[model samples]
Target: MSAALLPPSLSSIFSSSSSASNPYPLHCVSPPFNLAASRPARSFLLGATASYSDPSDLSLVSPTSDLTVQALDQKLLTLLRQRKTEDAWIAYTNSPHLPSPTCLSRLVSQLSFQNTRSALTRAQSIVTRLRHERQLHRLDANCLGLLAAAATKAGHTSYATSIVKSMLRSGYLPHVKAWSAVVSGLASSGDDGPVEALRLFKAVTRRVRKFNDLQIVSNSRPDTVAFNAALNACANLGDSEKFLQVFDEMPQYGVEPDALTYNVMIKLCCKTDRKDLLVFVLERILELGIPLCMTTLHSLVSAYVGFGDLKTAEKLVQAMREQRTDLCKILRESGSEDLVENDESVFKKLLPNLTKQSDNEPPLLPKVYAPNSRLYTTLMKGYMQAGRVSDTVKMLEAMRRQDDRSSHPDHVSYTTVVSALVKAGAMDRARQILAEMTRIGVPPNLMTYNILFKGYCMQLQIDQARELLKEMVDDAGIQPDVVSYNILIDGCILVDDSAGALAFFNEMRAKGIAPTKISYTTLMKAFALSGQPKLAHRVFDEMLNDPRVKADRIAWNMLVEGYCRLGLVEEAKKIIEKMKENGLYPDVATYGSLANGIALARRPGEALLLWNEVKERCRVDKEGGKSDSSIAPPLKPDEGLLDTLADICVRAAFFKKALEIVACMEEHGIPPNKTKFTRIYVEMHSRMFTSKHASQARQDRRIERKRAAEAFKFWLGLPNSYYGSEWRLEPIDGYDSDSL
Candidate 1:
């Protein structure tokens, strides 16, 4: 891919080659090409990965006048295949010819297979440029399909979704393979991806059917791969109906379900506690003569073990061992005659006792012929589910004792145990496991430190979190990133250590570790809640000056609210206009602050108008209209804002408006409680009695008492006649109505 394939956000990678300030450890795998070992130097390789802004020297190609565009393209591809990545990239970039979309697609395909950070970055740039610029209209089905495939392989789900959605919105439906890649990426993410994937699948299918265009429908139809992705999505999200619907639709799509497909279905059935469906899927697997891989057998074992059916699980395990021995014997007998007699399968039951193979025993089978780690890990998982922590640890230890490195316990195994301990609130035990990991020659990395940091924060042990942060650097020798700092700051704020949070914030900046949006937001909120609004503004202004840190909607809202809390309504209003100019509309927090500020500034009418505008925007957003000024989803009327409105109404002597405000609160399910309403009523009369005409009222005692009585009756929402004689109103614990 040429430089034209670079995304705008990625263009920076080409300009700067320095990696000095990077907190993460650099681990580069040298390629066959004579490329520089520096991080940026290895970023993009021609025909594999390429970024273009400054044109390469075209003189080299112009000297060879006979080099046609086709010949140059072929030469570049050959160089790439020969692992001369840099040479190929230089030649391609220096060539004067505009490469075809097919050539760009081929380059993207190469980049996808490489699981390096550089390769992933290059793939994103290429996919973005392809979809947004440079003949997007001319993108054929094959090109679209390959783009999604590349994104999936690179784990760029957001980029993949953007490409597909952009195409769909422009009436160019994606091919089945493209749709499958997207669904698979989202399903595997384990976040809100499951919900989004299911929604996208339904919307696309419905839209395709509604259009009823034969070509478009056929090209964009969901296949077994797509269905499998959707099924996995449902399984992750516990959407049982959606799972079964996808399972039942396989044959309708004329696609045969494979063993992996059945594995996922059985897993889902096990997860959803549908023993009947589990049996049904297992029976179908057998009926179809689908050779069960270890995954299928493991799922079966795990389900049985999970439900306390260990008697049946033991039988199933014995049967699986027998089957494996038979298959191995068959392979030894049927293949190479050069095999030694000792090559025959030797079966043994190594249970409960964890030990390495004896010196007299035959050498273990190669990794390709050995059982995968998951087969045992599955049993460990079952023991975990049964709450047998000791048993699970023993199983994990047994795996570690094995001779083959491939069969040893890995990071996932250790992390799983640590995660389980953390969830059970056994932080000490989890920390012990982390130490054990290092003792076993598996040194703890950034992820290990992060898990510990999060555990400390969740427990509200800010001091402990701070100590861990130091240990991560001083002992573990791992550089803490922005996430590490953010966690510590958040933990401090949770413990009301505002000064400590600010110290950490300053430390982060001094270390040249740029604060992210989360970092700024954390500090902003901490100071705001700590009643240091001026300091919050200082933080916001600092964020604004830093080019690397972009202030998001949350940051802006915090700035506005902080100003309002300081009774700086005009300052808050000025910030709102700046927010709009930056294409960020004021959200609920901003409006809430504005309303409160208006009331505090003695402008009740304007406050009412601002509150109404907020409601109107909320209504527009809720109905799914394109609200021009809507930056976020609508929120309920803020509690502080509601109280302020009530105060404003009482002070202005607009009792009718005050009642309406209370009614609105009831409709919104956040009605002002009795205690708050009574306080407001009392405050209203206190203000009325302390008026400028108090001296004159004292001279005319009878008139003063009459007016006070009438006001008290009005406040109680009673008829005027109720104040006549039966219910005589008097100042409580006071000398006189005017003097008190």
Candidate 2:
């Protein structure tokens, strides 16, 4: 984000607000997966949580010491007065006379009352102690500011307030510089923070009469800063009346609204949910004698959208057209028509320019058109999203016409289109696109790998994706991110290749990319779907025990359903309880499997009872309600649902579960279609006596037994009185009487 993008608070976070401080560095909060030649693998291990020791859970080092906190305070106070908390923080920490840890805590409290500050735990306690002792440092407002900053950093809010109150009572009035820091901090905290911070500024403003903090601390007259802070507060609060009142009062108090002031008010209008109110504001701005800029116009259009006033939005767009008619005529005459034939699209191209002027670029802010990479990519993405391959191709052609060969879709552009193709089950097209990207000299990024990996996995082409992984490593010199591994492993799991998935994981570990939530989840899914609850159990246990890596809820649920499938209700219940303890919830697929599992365990009564419970919880009705405590069991899976379930089982090669699902479908009076029957026949044979592992079959009798099992599964799903429904399709020559 740019500095101007911030209303004083976020300027610092992006290292442009008055000074550079990495006070609250933005953590990814998600997998920082880069299955490319970017990040060093070591960083991955660092981000993962190994254990949760409270003190060790966060950074404990400070940039400065306490003894010189007095000097640091002076510099900090100066920095704060300049609205430069980022720089101020650095100075405060570099001091030898740092606040004692207790004093540091007190300081945190004071800083938290700022408009956009988060709370820090250690800072809050210290601030509380400082407030209680009344030993708050009077000299270094810097110390006080740092303390509050720390509190906010730690997410401790209450203590931050007390610290602010302590500062106010101490006769320390702040100037725009000091106030801006607080305001920015509060803004960053949340939208509500700015509102509350404004009230605090008002209280301080009121106290100015009794305790002239500005005159005491500085050698200058009051500037427009305090008013700006108040205005910012009101703007974010979105109380138009309050904002106008503040605006009116600004002139009375010898202040004037600058570009920032107007920008804030306009943004408020943009975010306005009320069309009439926004229109009223637009009219009011005109009445108040301020010229409307494109910024104001955009805000107006945004407000119309908020109110769902497309007519008004169209009218506004038309009005903008009238204003830019001369420019549009010039563009048409200049022969740029072929590049963007659509006038509306051309207008869309111009809006970003108006919004994204350079800070140093004379703030006249001309009607600029800055089309970001996303806009073009979105058009391409739109075609891909709709599953229109031809349209997607057209989009690529359109992009080529608009941009130079040196400029093509980057990671996002390629990934979005590839992912959609993969999801649509169009592996061939996806591959072609990848090839096209490479041909265009736009080397594939990690996103490219993820897309291809997912597509290959879906098609059971695990070996191809693996080959790509090797290319990514040895050839591309890229380390596979956790997501890349996850997708590939998930594919392996789907194909019932636990051994293969495990080998990849070991490869992943050797390459130094530690497993993540998805990794564990995919492994768990493999075990659950493969009728290996033991392996699933071990994977689940490991994930839950480690706080550093989150557990995959999908995988856990799969295990619970697997347990239920094998007639282990107690074990399923135990896993369910464990999931609850971990704050995870079971999804619909998990419940469906469990319901079916319950019926097959010879507990049709329990299955019916549980099905109703699961249905009510999921807010999805299950067939018809049961009788008794529960009447009918929900084991009768619908054909559509069974087809989907079967597809999942077949993809994973879970023949046992797939056969069971077929039985469930028939029980519901749903007949298997041709596609499903073919899948069953092909996959059953593959599992029993075909595919890569066919030679592993024990004997010819084993193959005959497999055939018999398949036959039993088929006939059991057919109507009892139907022709040949009870016909034994297996070879009877190898039969044991006991098996029958």
Candidate 3:
């Protein structure tokens, strides 16, 4: 077969080259080539030779050129057949003429199959070369699909998408495995990835439909896996509407929803804050007779825990522990059945929306799943979140008492106990949990120690945090990661120790641990809080220079904060503009810092401008303008920011603006601090309008200010009348009226 692949003239040359007695013939005779030439030069030479061997212009090709092309092709084929990918790549690149489509495809298949970064790069190079040569269509579908999957696995989702799009543009529909990989990769990529994943899914579905109508058979039609990937993206985005749209489209494409499909639905429910539909989803799953899986059960418990409905989560876990097959009975026992029943309108938007079962309908039943360490840990997490330290400890004890080995407390369980204790400010108890973990042979990982470090840091016990860091390395032989350093840096910020924070930052770098965005941002925070805005700015600049870390919103906000902390409102506003230029709009924290800076700078007019911008961003266009969609979602001002701005307005005697800020506070459900404002008004404006100016314009301005003051007093529910004396000159018992 190898001999047949070669041209007759080259076959003899290959036979001569492979002579066992003279195996190193090329080395012995430097015939027509420079054997010492670089590999790239050899490739260029081969390509140049192959160009002359084209069959379309055979008359122009000499037999010598044909022989050279055949010899190179044979070499590439032999190397590929032996699975020597590196050598094959060398031979293929050095060849003057492109190899047969079959040979090229086989090479690509091998390279992609290796799944190493270098091999994937070489495979992508081959594909790119083929694309440049307008021969991409010659590669087989399986080869292209494998390349796409390999790229996706390597975290190059955009590259993978482009490959799939290339396949489509070349009139070849990609296989499900190919496009699905791209979709799943995009979905998990974070940021706007999920949105793009949904778009890709829809694009391919449309193409498949179009092809089906044209009587073309294509395996690229989205299957259950593809649909699930799309659904998971929706769950990530909290797009319940898009999720349902994709979910309902499954039946139209003849794809059945699987257990994972329903699992994503449960997550979507949690994400969209529709916890009331949890039971309804379970009922629908039961109605569809889908086999229950442990993940679905875990997701339900996790969703309930996230919603702070720990009772429902506990009931489910308890039922599972008791091996109750009728899980619906557990739902009823938890008393959330009524809530689910009352929310039919919520459930109807999804599937079956089962509320009350028919007389003949079978009840929802689940397999008896023994509670695993993860489920118990999740419950413990809920307790930790709710500040129930004792309950979290008890839950850990329950896990230890469970009979099943899978339910036995693990490192995560121990870590949760430590986290709960730390959150409750019981640092000693948290350390004791660490000791218990060591005693029980469950090794505390980096996360456990980091949690303790954070606990110590939060209490401003930087010394203990440092001690723990040393212990992590020397005692446990566990190296501190980026998170450990971030915690320590933040700890320094708490105590206003910028130098200490910088020491930790340098030490972290010295130890070869790359600082992440969090590390840089936390360090910036240290400098910012210490009133060293220049140092913070320097750190921010360094963060931008670091290739590994991208400055996120927090980092930008910290820079704004540093400037604002020093009452450098102009510098802060410049940073904000730069932040917007970088595609990040100022969020609540950004505005909060600016408000504080404005108050510090005594710039009430600037406060009014800031308020207008805030109001514009927060404006809801009831008319559904296209411009509104382009605007960022409204900024939800926290009480601190609102109070800062309002205080500035009140102090500056900008009473009308002050009233507007107060109204905004009430609109957002934050009650204005009337007592504080009333005190400020009485102290600052007690003698207002007492004297009239001689100039008419000055008097007119005074009158306006007084009326505004009166309106503000009226709003504060205070007396609008003046405090000046009409009958207040009388002396009490032993006091002198003249002196008063």
Candidate 4:
């Protein structure tokens, strides 16, 4: 453990990148914080194979009934943690008796991180059954964390809060980690009212103080951590003074600033890019003689990057390298072995954070070819984060010199670059990376090949993906993992090969990669998109047997959309109830997608009802906060997508319904733009004349044209948006003006 002592409060800064796989590790700022500060040589050895940490990590600290089981559990936890939840779940399902609840809990907790919605549900059901059966020897806090996390991830934020609340009532009150979790949950969810979260945190502290007053006033205060969390809450509030106070509390409360603390502060300072305070905090941290961590460096780099201040970030990036080297050097010399002793925080599984890769600035490595074979893998990961693949080759070439060949660049380097290339839709680059991996005698891991297969499958190159599957069997002889099979199933869906994909899914199940939600979602969307909503519902039923797939919102949303398209509003309503029963909450996208579905069904009145529901949702949910995305580009109530739905409605012989939808769209704020107005009058009339609807809707088109004339006049009078000349388009030769 650290001689400096554990602080009473340790704030966690969740620095999530955009990539699902590349989560920026929580930059925690707790005194005497070091990468290996408390992790033993055992954790490192296990990290190599296990690839992640399990909730039962603390369980492994004590003797288990089965030592072999314990070792495998450790390794499994590592894998789950490393954005490998599906792989872990597959292993758990295939294994006998399974790693204990705590072990499963860690994987469950990581569901959010892994985006394993299905796995989270299965694990939760297991936990529920275990509790009902009175199978617990002791309550595992880690499991509770996972439960709460899953609740939130499933979009039941209120239920997640309830889980945390119940945990406290069940005598787990001293753990502030849960409070921090709620903070993180709120932050990522873009939820409103963090002030309530802070109050709850305060209540927890008060309870702790009452229980142990002397400890509360100790030298190691957790103020730094808690204050940082408060500061994070401030970011949402945009409360500058409160934000500053949170920053000032780091030292005032005697809690030393660690990487996460700095990261939180850095983001807060950069929120407005107010340079005066930014310089002060930067100088203050340097003066404290505490080493600045990578998160803070990234934040600073990003902060300056925002103002087009690459020159400043570039200079600091160099300084950051110096700091990283110094810290690494200190760890290297600090007996390199003392890192094995520290910690008093309770173990807990966590909620997932959706992170994208964040390494796309200037190159961090030098052009010079001094290949530190040892850091080659690290450099590869860095390059991948920066979204570069060619650099991976450069590093590999450097490794070739001086016989520095260390077999392959290990999974980290390979997966990093490969994952990035795949996400950027650069299949060619991904293939090149895979080829280079094999060319250099570094046989690609099954995971690496999966990445390539997934990329190809996404681009609808099922033939190529299948060919690689054959290679895995013949040349590699490696069995496919669940993800490997999932990709193939998804590819089949894209090609409307439900029969084939179902066969593959069955094969996967036979091979023991038990189907997850994804297996069914593909089939559902495939059938639904193919105009077979009935088949979609049936697949959803079969998927529910897995427990995890039951009531999944993603599945529900697909079903709702499909049913809506078929004008099966009742079925769509049923799908929504299933979603809510599963504790999933719908977001704007979910609502927006469903609303469009209603319009397609010629249910303009129903669509308007759903639209009003959205307005209400937006009102109370000021929490989802405006996204950093371009401010929605001025959608008119009567414009954009309604036109498409109107077209569909008209095709379905719902002429009056199509006009109603158009009217609703106008009522919504997308009043018909010029093109839409023109289309409603001229385009619809043309299409009606061309199609068989002319007899019934021709008079309606005449009425629409009269309204369009007034709308055109209004649009022409508008300032910059007016385009009278553009609207003239030769007056649609021979168009009957008398219709108006």
Which number leads on lDDT? 3
lDDT value for model 4:
0.53
Span of 10 residues, lowest total lDDT, candidate 4: 345-354
lDDT of 3 by residue, 1-740 (tens): 12233224322322322211111111111111122222222121001111112222212223457677677778888888898987787677656567877788899899889987557656755654554344555578788888879978876565566667656655667789789988999888765679979988887887788753634544777889999999999999988778878988998878999889988888887787777567767777888889887888888889889989898898888888887877765664564444544454434657654535434343657556777999999999999999998899998888888778899999999999999888889999899999999998999999999999999999999999998888889999999877899989989889878777877877776564656678888878877887778777877886675433468899999999998988999999999999988888899999999999998888888998998887766564222323544566557788998899889989989886787788888988999999999999889887777775458877854655565677688887777753342312233334342310
Cα lDDT listed for each candidate: 0.61, 0.52, 0.75, 0.53
lDDT of 4 at 245: 54
Using TM-score, give the best candidate's number: 3
The residue-by-residue lDDT of candidate 4 on 1-740, one tens digit each, is: 12133122111101211111212111111111111213421111000012333322222233435776777787787786676767776666544445766666576566534435444445544443333333432335565666565555554444456556655555554244555566555554443536655555555555555555556434223455566666677766656666655555456446666656556655655564543233334434544455654444445455555545444544454444343433222212322232223321110000001010122221222212222333454545455556666776576555555344442456556666788788778988787877877786667888888888888888989999989899878887788977788888888878877666656765665453545567678767776776678767766665553322344567878777778677777788777767766666565445556666676566655654554454444434344544534332122232444555554544444444445555556666665444544454454443432354456566656544534443343342432222444443122435543311
Shift in Å, residue 319, candidate 1: 19
Looking at model 1, the pairs that clash are: 3-52, 45-49, 46-89
- Which digits, one per residue and each the tens of the lDDT, describe model 2 over residues 1-740? 12233233222222331012212222223222222223333221111111122222223245555545456566656665675544544443444443444334333434444434222322332332332333334234555555544444444332344345545655545444544445545654552567767666666656654544544544222346656666667666766667666666665446655545555655564444432233334433443456555555555454444445444444544444344422222312222222333323212221233222222222222344333344445445545655666666665565566544433556567776777778788888887877877787777788888888988888899998989888888976777887898888889987878767766655565454546667777777766776768667776765564433545567677788668667677688778777766666555565566655654565544543453454344232343544543232333334444565555444444444455556556655777564665555555544444445445546643554455445544544532222554545333565552321
Worst 10 residues of 2 by lDDT: 44-53
By TM-score, how accurate is candidate 1? 0.56
Clash pairs for candidate 3: 43-94, 46-96, 47-96
Clashes of each: 3, 54, 3, 34
Error of 3 at 220 (Å): 2.7
RMSD values for the candidates in order, in angstroms, are 15.0, 17.2, 14.3, 17.0
TM-score of 4: 0.51
